[model samples]
Target: MSRVRIAAEIAGAAVLLVAAIGIGAFLREQRTEPQSPAAAPLAESLAAPTQRPQPNCAVLGQVTPVPVPPLATVDLANGKKSITSAEGGYTVIVPTAWLVQPGIIEGTAWFGQTRITSYDPKTLPRPGPEAPGILPPSFGISLDLQLWWNPKGEALDQFAQHMLIGPDQLAVLPGGVVSVGGKQAYRTTIQDQRQYQPATGPVITTRQTRIVWIVPTDRNDRVLVAYATPGESDLFPEVEKIVGAIVLTTPASPTLPVIHQRDEILGRWLYDKSGAPIAGRRAEAKLLTYGETVAAFGGGTGLPRIDRDPDELFWLVAVTGPDLPQGRGGPGGTSPPTAWIMYEAPATNDRYEGAGTRFASAGTWPADFDALPDRCR
Candidate 1:
């Protein structure tokens, strides 16, 4: 080989040796470098042991069974009693322990009767007279009225107003929603003062009232189940458990018509104490039939009064209208009813008018003849 070529080859070999040394140094540095602290495990401790859930006392509490009582024993003349004739167009199992009573105002198809029964004192409060601790059991037949007409929330507010609470009234707590009696329901708890009559003085008993509003699926029907106790605490858990056990099987179809015969009498008309009509002025009449008997009243000149009752055999005055304003007097507001007083009874005549009262007048008829509107005709 030429001397210059040999010198070039030697220089190339020296450069290759330097490159190999540099690569080896870089790899060695990489292998010996310390790892970042963040990459290391935070601690050598083991993970926390799995926690056991706390036991719920409500679920564990012993349930008190409701006592059964005879129907005759429950029906004490003054006490109300009603038997379950129908349930959802099906036969129902009569609750052996409960005593049913006819509603104070009877004859509506939707409302049958109220139910009454005493619960275990351990589970409920003991009954005492004069603001007694006794629970006045009640039941309602489902009506097809508009549900939106009376919202459960608003109804609950009304119930709260009627309830008597304790001196140390606790705050009301919302319990959310739950299923009750196979129906959707909202549950809530309220702490209130219950008035109790003591031999010495009036005692204010602290209590918790649990309310459940059940909205039916088929109709605008709703069932309200309420349980109250003497304490400033929650009774929902127990109340729900007890109410859930209630099996309300439908009863047999009523032999009598679903709507009583008297329902026909419930409408607007005019009448007097003798069933006589007042001349020159007409009074709006309304009838409310319950069961076999009927209640009729007339208003417009003033609030209505009971006019007649074929069954009751006498006229009974029920309610009176308020005094009219100066210019807004009489049925037309042109003049006050002269000796014109609204009256209600079981019977009345066609024409009977006195001074200050016009006997002849014309007015619009109600839309429905079967029943009167809730407001004045």
Candidate 2:
């Protein structure tokens, strides 16, 4: 099996381009008759938000709690470009010199001298008619923003302590705290060594520096911001400036009618390895609701398949079934799933277990699980 870097996994389906008339048709289909005035108040009242005391940022594992200035007040006067994402639920100012391409899994913006990439689970790739044949721009320096969920509300230091050395080594920094999007956040500096084989020579070792920021959000989630630079290169100060100008919009709370335990597993799920979207392959889990019993099966390419029987082979693990585990999901699984388990390959025994992240429903999932076995098994 070829070893692939999880960090390199960024795939987005191409956005569908439609004519004005097509958009009109879509709008018309969604139009419904107006409700009576007598019922309008009840509907409005039901949608009103309930008030609760604000939670302390520090207690929530946020390091800095400085007052945040209005997003418009930021010194973005020199910026010639602005990126606003209704789906990403955030707005930030970038230099006009940067090149921007927004995707559902991750958004890439290339600054003349730097590249900034932002990723959040709440923002997923909008399903396009097909995959766009677009190539990502290159930059010597990269800034990465990813989403992290802290449902248990672990302390910043404790959570940081539990961080894995995945593909890199991290050294905790003495820097007090950093602020982003008017929220308190912590920072860490990491040094990583990467090896690549040359066509005609031995492997080369390269050292890089990554400065990361952990910024919390409204939900029990946080955005991880990191600035990566080449050997001996210092770009945190410049990158921090771009990050500071960010203003994250609150994520929309999902509203759905009460769901049955079995039907909750119906939506699309993106297969992930250790929290990162798997490259190239699109994995989906399907559940057939049979009376009161929900049968589950997992299928996807680019990973090993579990064959238990000859007639049918599925990748699965037995959980309590009804009550799914609560944890963060990736592109496919938007909200925390009821329960989740990793997909384990039989070869390594238990070395490589692929986890599935819940994503928004595309409304086009196949009812049959047979196709999955064909591609996966």
Candidate 3:
């Protein structure tokens, strides 16, 4: 063969060999790559159904069954009261002379009555949508009733800021502090009449109201009682009389403090109120001091890692399946293939009520460091 022709043939052979090796490598790669597990069934089980089961409309409507609790009657005229039996999980207290109205208040989510004594429950609607009934009258002594019926601890701060402070009707005044019934309270006056617009439009209005933020001395609770009247001038005198007359007997909480550290929480523990583990069955924990900003993991789950901010009133940490990378598992070990969670630490004492201290909202750190989950006595 001529030299040029031989060289051309050799080059052609080299090209074919390269192409063959490339194809072989591609095939090997395809075989070696791992296949992700089929996440459909897992996802379906983990995800809440978009549609809820509808009741059988064809069936005739049945009368609603009511659970009866023991009712106690009080004769205000003679100042006589009797408790037959405490049946409901919650205890209801009324003044001797107050008239109790039975039934749900209009535009309320639940059924309850307004008890009118010297004070009118009808006048006091719940501070937020979650609560219903008449708000307390303007006695000048107001309570910032922080509501968190089923909220995570980390979200309590944000809930307070957005709901109470955002109203513009109430403003946190500078250096407003007082003592109510021996409880150190922070008082702030409402500068203007604020209106909250519900889905149906403005359902409630307030004017010249004062909010007293009472932080407990040693608990994770804060109470915001708002006192307002039609007029705007200083209502401190009436507030003093009303506040002085308030008899607050601390109710027993299901969750008691197992460990109290100065501004740092560690380990896994169960929450007292809900009897659920503070460390969700699938949670992890790290020691965070007061004022350190911790990033929340997972997505959409408003779980907050307590950060160190002097203004932060509450700090709690919790985790769940969605907070983990593997997603939340179900009873049968099923979980979503993908999940997201986040943790937040709020700077306001309004996160937890009924157990907050006067210094709680002041951002005071705990002094000792003891993580005792077993001590949940």
Against the true structure, whose TM-score is highest? 2
TM-score winner, 1 or 2? 2
The 0-to-1 C-alpha lDDT of every candidate, in the order given, reads: 0.28, 0.34, 0.30
Superposition error at 115 for model 2 (Å): 7.5
Clashes of each: 59, 12, 60
C-alpha RMSD by candidate, in order: 41.0, 20.2, 25.5
TM-score, candidate 2, is 0.40
Candidate 2 whole-model C-alpha lDDT, 0 to 1: 0.34
lDDT of 3 by residue, 162-210 (tens): 3332223445444355665566555544344445567875556644444
- Give TM per candidate: 0.35, 0.40, 0.32
Q: Which prediction has more favorable TM-score, 2 or 3? A: 2
Tens digit of per-residue lDDT, candidate 1, span 144-225: 1111112233444343333322233445655556665575555555554355656896674634343434333232322333
State the lDDT of candidate 2 residue by residue for 1-377, as single tens digits: 11211232232111111222332332233113221234223223222121232221122222233322211212346765665543334666655554444321233221111234332222333322121211112223445444443435775544554443334444545444777788787766655555557677777555455566666666553334334333243444556787776777764322111121111121112222234422222223322211101122233311111101111212221221111223333555454323223221111011111222222212222234324321111
Off by over 4 Å in 3: 1-170, 193-207, 213-215, 220-239, 248-250, 254-377
User: Evaluated with lDDT, which candidate comes out highest?
Assistant: 2
